[model samples]
Target: MNLSLQFNPELFRDPNRFCVYVHGLPEMPVAWVGFCRVADVLISPDAYASQAWRDTALTAPLISLTVTDVCETEGEAMRAALRLVRMYQPPINLRSGPVSSRSGRKVMCLETGVTYDTAAAAARANGLFESQLSVYLNRRSTGKIRGLTFKRV
Candidate 1:
Protein backbone atom coordinates (compact mmCIF):
# COMPACT_ATOMS: atom_id res chain seq x y z
CA MET A 1 0.00 0.00 0.00
CA ASN A 2 1.18 3.49 -0.76
CA LEU A 3 1.98 5.20 2.55
CA SER A 4 1.47 8.58 0.93
CA LEU A 5 -2.13 7.65 0.19
CA GLN A 6 -2.69 5.92 3.53
CA PHE A 7 -1.41 8.85 5.63
CA ASN A 8 -3.38 11.44 3.73
CA PRO A 9 -5.07 13.75 6.20
CA GLU A 10 -8.15 14.06 4.04
CA LEU A 11 -8.91 10.40 4.50
CA PHE A 12 -9.24 10.77 8.27
CA ARG A 13 -11.13 14.02 8.58
CA ASP A 14 -14.33 12.67 10.12
CA PRO A 15 -14.44 13.09 13.90
CA ASN A 16 -17.68 11.25 14.62
CA ARG A 17 -17.01 8.22 12.44
CA PHE A 18 -14.99 5.19 13.50
CA CYS A 19 -12.33 3.85 11.19
CA VAL A 20 -11.00 0.30 11.12
CA TYR A 21 -7.23 0.37 10.75
CA VAL A 22 -5.01 -2.63 10.02
CA HIS A 23 -1.37 -2.51 11.00
CA GLY A 24 1.17 -4.80 9.34
CA LEU A 25 4.09 -5.10 7.02
CA PRO A 26 3.62 -5.10 3.25
CA GLU A 27 3.17 -8.59 1.76
CA MET A 28 3.01 -10.08 5.27
CA PRO A 29 0.00 -11.22 7.22
CA VAL A 30 -1.82 -8.45 9.08
CA ALA A 31 -0.30 -8.18 12.53
CA TRP A 32 -3.05 -6.11 14.14
CA VAL A 33 -6.49 -4.70 13.43
CA GLY A 34 -8.84 -2.46 15.39
CA PHE A 35 -11.37 0.35 15.14
CA CYS A 36 -11.21 3.79 16.65
CA ARG A 37 -12.29 7.31 16.00
CA VAL A 38 -10.45 8.83 13.03
CA ALA A 39 -9.12 11.48 15.35
CA ASP A 40 -7.38 8.85 17.48
CA VAL A 41 -5.26 7.79 14.55
CA LEU A 42 -4.22 11.29 13.59
CA ILE A 43 -1.07 12.84 15.00
CA SER A 44 -2.15 15.48 17.48
CA PRO A 45 -1.94 16.27 21.20
CA ASP A 46 -5.56 15.50 21.95
CA ALA A 47 -5.50 12.47 19.65
CA TYR A 48 -2.94 9.81 18.72
CA ALA A 49 -1.52 10.23 22.19
CA SER A 50 -1.16 6.51 22.80
CA GLN A 51 2.58 5.98 23.12
CA ALA A 52 2.16 2.23 23.51
CA TRP A 53 0.16 1.89 20.31
CA ARG A 54 2.53 4.17 18.42
CA ASP A 55 5.56 2.25 19.71
CA THR A 56 4.15 -1.05 18.54
CA ALA A 57 2.52 0.02 15.28
CA LEU A 58 4.56 2.98 14.03
CA THR A 59 8.09 2.37 15.26
CA ALA A 60 8.87 -0.01 12.42
CA PRO A 61 9.23 1.75 9.09
CA LEU A 62 7.88 -1.24 7.18
CA ILE A 63 4.62 -1.29 9.14
CA SER A 64 1.66 0.27 7.33
CA LEU A 65 -1.80 1.35 8.34
CA THR A 66 -4.70 0.73 6.01
CA VAL A 67 -8.21 1.96 6.68
CA THR A 68 -10.36 -0.95 5.72
CA ASP A 69 -13.75 0.39 6.71
CA VAL A 70 -15.61 3.32 8.19
CA CYS A 71 -18.85 3.21 10.13
CA GLU A 72 -21.33 5.74 11.46
CA THR A 73 -21.56 3.99 14.83
CA GLU A 74 -18.92 2.50 17.12
CA GLY A 75 -20.72 -0.82 17.33
CA GLU A 76 -20.78 -1.23 13.57
CA ALA A 77 -17.10 -0.34 13.38
CA MET A 78 -16.29 -2.80 16.17
CA ARG A 79 -18.20 -5.60 14.46
CA ALA A 80 -16.47 -4.85 11.19
CA ALA A 81 -13.11 -4.83 12.91
CA LEU A 82 -13.89 -8.16 14.61
CA ARG A 83 -14.85 -9.65 11.26
CA LEU A 84 -11.57 -8.52 9.76
CA VAL A 85 -9.65 -9.91 12.74
CA ARG A 86 -11.35 -13.27 12.30
CA MET A 87 -10.56 -13.30 8.61
CA TYR A 88 -6.93 -12.23 8.96
CA GLN A 89 -6.05 -14.24 12.13
CA PRO A 90 -3.53 -11.61 13.06
CA PRO A 91 -0.86 -12.98 15.44
CA ILE A 92 -0.58 -9.64 17.20
CA ASN A 93 -4.18 -9.50 18.31
CA LEU A 94 -4.74 -8.30 21.86
CA ARG A 95 -6.07 -11.65 23.01
CA SER A 96 -2.93 -13.51 21.99
CA GLY A 97 -0.85 -12.09 24.86
CA PRO A 98 2.52 -10.41 24.55
CA VAL A 99 4.94 -11.66 21.91
CA SER A 100 8.41 -12.29 23.22
CA SER A 101 11.27 -12.38 20.73
CA ARG A 102 14.01 -13.71 22.98
CA SER A 103 12.48 -15.19 26.07
CA GLY A 104 13.18 -18.87 25.60
CA ARG A 105 16.10 -18.77 23.24
CA LYS A 106 19.62 -19.52 24.43
CA VAL A 107 22.01 -16.61 24.33
CA MET A 108 25.78 -16.92 24.12
CA CYS A 109 28.02 -14.28 25.59
CA LEU A 110 30.88 -13.80 23.17
CA GLU A 111 33.13 -12.25 25.77
CA THR A 112 32.81 -15.15 28.19
CA GLY A 113 32.22 -17.82 25.56
CA VAL A 114 29.39 -19.11 27.74
CA THR A 115 25.86 -19.85 26.68
CA TYR A 116 22.90 -19.21 28.95
CA ASP A 117 19.75 -21.25 28.83
CA THR A 118 17.62 -18.25 27.99
CA ALA A 119 17.89 -14.56 27.26
CA ALA A 120 16.47 -13.85 30.70
CA ALA A 121 19.20 -15.85 32.41
CA ALA A 122 21.86 -14.11 30.35
CA ALA A 123 20.45 -10.70 31.11
CA ARG A 124 20.26 -11.47 34.82
CA ALA A 125 23.87 -12.64 34.95
CA ASN A 126 25.04 -9.63 32.97
CA GLY A 127 23.15 -7.08 35.02
CA LEU A 128 21.12 -5.90 32.04
CA PHE A 129 17.43 -5.52 31.61
CA GLU A 130 15.82 -8.19 29.49
CA SER A 131 14.32 -5.47 27.32
CA GLN A 132 17.72 -3.87 26.80
CA LEU A 133 19.14 -7.25 25.88
CA SER A 134 16.29 -7.73 23.43
CA VAL A 135 17.13 -4.44 21.78
CA TYR A 136 20.72 -5.50 21.27
CA LEU A 137 19.72 -8.88 19.94
CA ASN A 138 17.31 -7.34 17.46
CA ARG A 139 19.81 -4.84 16.14
CA ARG A 140 21.80 -5.50 12.97
CA SER A 141 25.06 -4.91 14.80
CA THR A 142 27.08 -7.51 16.74
CA GLY A 143 24.76 -7.17 19.76
CA LYS A 144 27.53 -5.56 21.79
CA ILE A 145 27.24 -3.66 25.07
CA ARG A 146 29.81 -2.58 27.61
CA GLY A 147 32.61 -4.48 25.79
CA LEU A 148 30.48 -7.66 25.81
CA THR A 149 28.71 -9.19 22.85
CA PHE A 150 25.90 -11.70 22.68
CA LYS A 151 24.24 -13.88 20.07
CA ARG A 152 21.49 -16.41 19.90
CA VAL A 153 22.71 -19.98 19.91
Candidate 2:
Protein backbone atom coordinates (compact mmCIF):
# COMPACT_ATOMS: atom_id res chain seq x y z
CA MET A 1 0.00 0.00 0.00
CA ASN A 2 1.32 3.40 -0.96
CA LEU A 3 1.44 5.88 1.94
CA SER A 4 0.88 9.48 0.95
CA LEU A 5 2.71 12.33 2.59
CA GLN A 6 -0.51 13.55 4.19
CA PHE A 7 -1.92 10.13 4.76
CA ASN A 8 -3.92 9.76 7.95
CA PRO A 9 -2.35 7.49 10.51
CA GLU A 10 -5.88 6.65 11.60
CA LEU A 11 -6.28 4.84 8.31
CA PHE A 12 -4.18 2.13 9.90
CA ARG A 13 -5.64 2.52 13.39
CA ASP A 14 -5.48 -1.04 14.49
CA PRO A 15 -3.04 -0.95 17.36
CA ASN A 16 -2.91 -4.71 17.63
CA ARG A 17 -2.13 -5.55 14.01
CA PHE A 18 1.42 -5.76 12.78
CA CYS A 19 2.36 -3.77 9.68
CA VAL A 20 4.94 -5.08 7.26
CA TYR A 21 6.87 -2.30 5.52
CA VAL A 22 8.47 -2.99 2.18
CA HIS A 23 10.93 -0.89 0.22
CA GLY A 24 11.24 -0.80 -3.57
CA LEU A 25 8.67 -2.53 -5.73
CA PRO A 26 6.30 -4.75 -3.83
CA GLU A 27 6.55 -7.51 -6.43
CA MET A 28 10.32 -8.06 -6.70
CA PRO A 29 13.73 -6.87 -5.67
CA VAL A 30 12.40 -5.69 -2.33
CA ALA A 31 15.13 -3.64 -0.68
CA TRP A 32 13.84 -4.28 2.83
CA VAL A 33 11.01 -5.72 4.92
CA GLY A 34 10.34 -4.99 8.58
CA PHE A 35 7.29 -5.31 10.79
CA CYS A 36 5.99 -2.93 13.45
CA ARG A 37 2.85 -1.53 14.91
CA VAL A 38 1.15 1.50 13.40
CA ALA A 39 2.02 3.60 16.43
CA ASP A 40 5.70 2.70 16.22
CA VAL A 41 6.18 4.22 12.76
CA LEU A 42 2.97 5.57 11.25
CA ILE A 43 1.40 7.43 14.18
CA SER A 44 4.64 8.93 15.39
CA PRO A 45 5.86 11.46 12.86
CA ASP A 46 9.40 11.45 14.19
CA ALA A 47 9.60 7.68 13.92
CA TYR A 48 8.02 7.75 10.48
CA ALA A 49 10.46 10.33 9.17
CA SER A 50 13.46 8.61 10.77
CA GLN A 51 13.72 6.08 7.99
CA ALA A 52 15.94 8.08 5.64
CA TRP A 53 15.92 5.30 3.09
CA ARG A 54 12.19 5.68 2.65
CA ASP A 55 12.48 9.33 1.76
CA THR A 56 15.43 8.65 -0.52
CA ALA A 57 13.60 5.95 -2.39
CA LEU A 58 10.46 8.07 -2.71
CA THR A 59 12.43 10.92 -4.21
CA ALA A 60 14.36 8.56 -6.44
CA PRO A 61 11.13 7.79 -8.31
CA LEU A 62 10.58 4.48 -6.57
CA ILE A 63 7.72 3.35 -4.41
CA SER A 64 8.52 3.09 -0.71
CA LEU A 65 6.53 2.13 2.40
CA THR A 66 4.46 -0.55 0.77
CA VAL A 67 2.37 -2.32 3.43
CA THR A 68 2.57 -5.83 2.09
CA ASP A 69 0.62 -7.54 4.87
CA VAL A 70 -1.28 -6.74 8.05
CA CYS A 71 -1.02 -9.70 10.37
CA GLU A 72 -3.15 -10.39 13.42
CA THR A 73 -0.17 -11.09 15.64
CA GLU A 74 3.41 -9.87 15.73
CA GLY A 75 4.62 -13.44 15.36
CA GLU A 76 2.59 -13.92 12.19
CA ALA A 77 3.96 -10.71 10.72
CA MET A 78 7.48 -11.76 11.67
CA ARG A 79 7.02 -15.10 9.96
CA ALA A 80 5.73 -13.43 6.83
CA ALA A 81 8.54 -10.88 6.86
CA LEU A 82 11.13 -13.65 7.30
CA ARG A 83 9.64 -15.55 4.39
CA LEU A 84 9.93 -12.47 2.19
CA VAL A 85 13.46 -11.84 3.38
CA ARG A 86 14.46 -15.37 2.44
CA MET A 87 12.74 -15.18 -0.93
CA TYR A 88 14.14 -11.79 -1.92
CA GLN A 89 17.42 -11.95 0.01
CA PRO A 90 17.47 -8.17 0.05
CA PRO A 91 20.79 -6.65 1.01
CA ILE A 92 19.44 -3.65 2.88
CA ASN A 93 17.44 -5.80 5.29
CA LEU A 94 20.60 -6.54 7.23
CA ARG A 95 19.99 -3.14 8.82
CA SER A 96 16.45 -4.11 9.79
CA GLY A 97 17.66 -5.79 13.01
CA PRO A 98 17.65 -9.34 14.34
CA VAL A 99 14.77 -10.52 12.16
CA SER A 100 17.11 -10.36 9.17
CA SER A 101 19.00 -13.40 10.41
CA ARG A 102 16.01 -15.75 10.19
CA SER A 103 16.84 -16.80 6.65
CA GLY A 104 18.83 -20.03 6.81
CA ARG A 105 19.50 -21.15 10.36
CA LYS A 106 18.82 -24.76 11.11
CA VAL A 107 17.21 -25.36 14.51
CA MET A 108 16.68 -28.62 16.28
CA CYS A 109 14.37 -29.30 19.20
CA LEU A 110 16.37 -31.14 21.80
CA GLU A 111 13.28 -32.49 23.52
CA THR A 112 11.42 -33.63 20.43
CA GLY A 113 14.45 -34.34 18.28
CA VAL A 114 12.82 -32.52 15.35
CA THR A 115 15.03 -30.44 13.14
CA TYR A 116 13.66 -27.53 11.17
CA ASP A 117 15.29 -26.14 8.08
CA THR A 118 14.89 -22.62 9.42
CA ALA A 119 14.18 -20.97 12.74
CA ALA A 120 10.96 -19.61 11.32
CA ALA A 121 9.87 -23.10 10.44
CA ALA A 122 10.60 -24.33 13.93
CA ALA A 123 8.75 -21.46 15.52
CA ARG A 124 5.77 -21.95 13.24
CA ALA A 125 5.52 -25.67 13.84
CA ASN A 126 6.02 -25.46 17.58
CA GLY A 127 4.01 -22.26 18.21
CA LEU A 128 7.02 -20.50 19.70
CA PHE A 129 8.51 -17.12 19.02
CA GLU A 130 11.43 -17.05 16.62
CA SER A 131 13.18 -14.57 18.86
CA GLN A 132 12.95 -16.95 21.79
CA LEU A 133 14.46 -19.71 19.73
CA SER A 134 17.26 -17.40 18.71
CA VAL A 135 17.98 -16.67 22.35
CA TYR A 136 18.26 -20.35 23.22
CA LEU A 137 20.53 -21.00 20.28
CA ASN A 138 22.69 -17.99 21.02
CA ARG A 139 23.03 -18.64 24.72
CA ARG A 140 23.90 -22.32 24.22
CA SER A 141 22.63 -22.95 27.73
CA THR A 142 21.19 -26.26 28.81
CA GLY A 143 18.23 -24.57 30.49
CA LYS A 144 14.80 -25.00 28.96
CA ILE A 145 12.00 -22.54 28.50
CA ARG A 146 8.37 -23.64 28.30
CA GLY A 147 9.67 -27.15 28.57
CA LEU A 148 11.24 -26.90 25.11
CA THR A 149 14.96 -27.03 24.45
CA PHE A 150 16.52 -25.79 21.24
CA LYS A 151 19.94 -25.77 19.65
CA ARG A 152 21.43 -24.49 16.45
CA VAL A 153 22.24 -27.27 14.07
Which window of 10 residues has the lowest lDDT sum in candidate 2? Answer: 1-10
- Positional deviation of 19 in candidate 2, in angstroms? 2.0
Off by over 4 Å in 1: 1-14, 25-65, 90-153
Question: Backbone clashes in each candidate structure, one number apiece?
Answer: 0, 0
What tens digits encode model 2's per-residue C-alpha lDDT throughout 1-153? 221111112236665654444434333221333433333332334534556644554455444444435567644654554454344332212112222243544332333243344434534554444433221221124322211212221
C-alpha lDDT of all candidate models, in order = 0.36, 0.36
> In candidate 1, what residue range of length 10 has the lowest lDDT sum?
1-10
Candidate 1 lDDT by residue in tens digits, 1-153: 111111111345665554444443333322333423333332344333455545645555565454445566544643454454334333222221222454543332333233334444544664554422221122234322211112221
Residue 5's lDDT in candidate 1: 13
- TM-score, candidate number 2: 0.28
In model 2, the Cα lDDT at residue 112 comes to: 27
